[model samples]
Target: MSSIPVGKGIPVDHVVDNTAEHPGERAPLVLNMHEFNDVTTTVCRVAESRRVPMAWYVAFVFSLGLLGFLGFCIAYLFATGVGVWGLNNPVMWAFDITNFVFWVGIGHAGTLISAILFLFRQKWRTGINRFAEAMTIFAVICAGIFPGIHVGRVWVIYWVFPIPNQMEMWPQFRSPLLWDVFAVSTYFTVSLLFWYTGMVPDLATLRDRARGKIRQIGYGLFALGWRGSNRHWHRYERAYLLLAALSTPLVLSVHSVVSFDFAVSQLPGWHTTIFPPYFVAGAIFSGFAMVVTLAVPARELFGLKDLITLRHLDNMNKIILVTGSMVGYAYSIEFFIAWYSGAMYEKFAFLNRAFGQYWWAYFIMVSCNVITPQLFWFKRIRTSIWGMFILSLIVNIGMWFERFVIIVSSLANDFLPTSWDVFIPTWVDIGTMIGSFGLFMTLFLLFCRYLPMIAMAEVKAVMPEADPHHDDHASDAKDEEGGANS
Candidate 1:
């Protein structure tokens, strides 16, 4: 039998007279072209044959229905006015502001995991990073929609932009609203650019792997002639690193600016110094929850169990636990400071949040965000699909209630008892909020169905074979020693 040279081009054939004597030191067999083809074929067959679960279909239908309800809400709001919702004198920022904050907070996790974890060099992030990035972009899209429409004059939303317009009115630099305009817009632009850039390499992979003209053309166009050449990789890597650096600060600042909208105001609950860090923490907490919610199902559906292993899930749960604890700490600190400061307004606002007209919302927030994640301390719980799934859903509920409690409780009981009235959300308010869920899920489902849910190349890059040392001198020495000793 002919032998193949491995390292130094020395060839030897039929080295052992007795075949049994030269029993090869069996290193783990690296996947070759044939194995890759087999694996790909198996994956394609399974993906094609497996029926999408009834639950996804049900969710898709329900989400679409909710999206339709959102459309109806928009129409009603347009036809009648902004007065269809509960916003009124003294409580000017109600449901719209709440929804805006909620969605923005939801958008935070995607960027945090994608950018921050990337910066930190977490190899496991490769499994879910792309999806998280997509989530960030979509969540921002959903987030940007509410604040724009909430202004009542949606057509004139461009007035928020500092472009040279016919009106020649520059948006007030002093206004937190203006800061929000810059912050959110910059965030969306940077995030979209980041997400799109990351997708290019993956899109190219999909394009090459395409079966038909349609997919070839579509993915090719999106991929922008990527060849994965060393030059392209070099440039791409630099650009990604630069973007990550830029985005890191924006992640902290954007939410801080959002918080300024409340904290800058002299209103009791709104005027807290803790709002910036508190808002940022809550955003990250909710964002991570949303990531897990989408990722768990996507991993299962796409047969990415090997790529997104239990280790990844465990890591995500740890993040959830850490961030959830941070949020809980923020909640405690807020309460402590409110009481210790001996400020009556601050005291009243904290009291009202916990035991006021919307005490249920506050309790829900605590139970969902703080109490639920405490279960992650158990390794079995953290790794269990059902446990993570339930916790993620609970986190979503808790986060929503957090926004609700912050917005409604603060507004419902102001300094003037005369002006304090219970602010109930109208049907329009309810519909739009529910519709946002539909919008998010619909986009997410489409992403899962179409996209290469796992970052194939990145995952490969992190695997043992990718390590230069994996099959080098030490491994060779061990193999030779074993062979010689045998």
Candidate 2:
């Protein structure tokens, strides 16, 4: 248990022997338990602080206003009917469907960042995984709300599912809408479980550290008596691994199923086989952009620069670039195939998307998603806080426009020329879309204020000092030198 001298060159065998005797010795000899504990304490201290800024209050107020707008829109829609929006005969699925797909696509980035990156052993994810996972859950909640209300009666929305009824009328499994019901519902459930499971250990850390009675009770109950015991850690690790594996496929499949709602149909632009991968890529692309948009500000606001470092931002930016490129590729392929296939309807769909009524929307999408993300190849741009923040916002805007272009342009001009008509969204349509943003921000702000946005324990686990090999390297180097000398 004897400690190594501070400055002297201790024999490599001596260091190794001591490390074997006391596994928690300081670096160069063993793991630095003290440093790990100190880092964890510092993170928790910052996270638990009760001070709220004036900006947070302003944001909360604005969010409430948006929520009020949502309430008004819903009430109007219920009283007046779905006719309040711009859904006409041909363009039956307009802004409502577009918004649903847009939000659902936005939700994909969170799970991809947390689960997919975790599976790849990306240590930087530890910094923002908790926040990203929370974003996934909240975004899904936002996404789920649209489709629920999109079906005029809202009350009859539950009929999409199979329930115990005397009539024995089961939802048609063959319908894409029914598939959407199952896909979105399953995604929400799995994401919530994944998010909550990750939070349990962190909640326990908060519970043990909390001073206030309310915090103690709240965090304690959520922690489920997690004590970081070896037994519990063993089980927790296995469960987490299983959940991540399960979620990865769900992330891909849920959005693919969603895309099927458009792709499986005989609509000129919608019938392409590439829709599944294309939609999933677009979803991840936009989702990552949204994650960056929110995370960059939250990390700065919460003074979490050290925990959510430049490394984490760089990784997220890289994802955005890759996915954006994939989406761009899909767009090009779609156009090429449309022309090469010699399908008159398909050719017209692509040409119409570019030069049609919604030409501006198509250009906005290309510029925002395809062109802007190309900047990420430069390390300086991706790592620069302001550069990334601006790019991320642009990406979100572009992705939204992409959906607008796809849904509106395709439906506005179908097979029959006599039936062709341009679709325009009413103020109510725009209001509700903006209101969903309000809901998402409101929930996010609450999360930042109350919960530990950064996963403290997980971050600590990934720190350099926590690596058993980090210090052992020095000893190993010395051992080789000693062998040479002998």
* Best-matching candidate per TM-score: 2
Cα deviation of 13 in candidate 2 (Å)? 29
Error of 2 at 91 (Å): 0.9
lDDT of 1 by residue, 280-396 (tens): 988988888888888787767656665556667777888899989999999999999999989999999999899987888999999999998999999889888899999999998
lDDT of each: 0.77, 0.81
Give the C-alpha miss distance for residue 70 in model 2, angstroms. 1.2
Regions of candidate 1 where Cα sits further than 4 Å from its true position: 1-56, 165-167, 473-486
Query: What TM-score would every model get versus the actual structure?
Result: 0.87, 0.90
Task: Give lDDT tens digits, candidate 2, residues 224-286.
Answer: 999999898899889999999999999999999999999989999999999999999999999
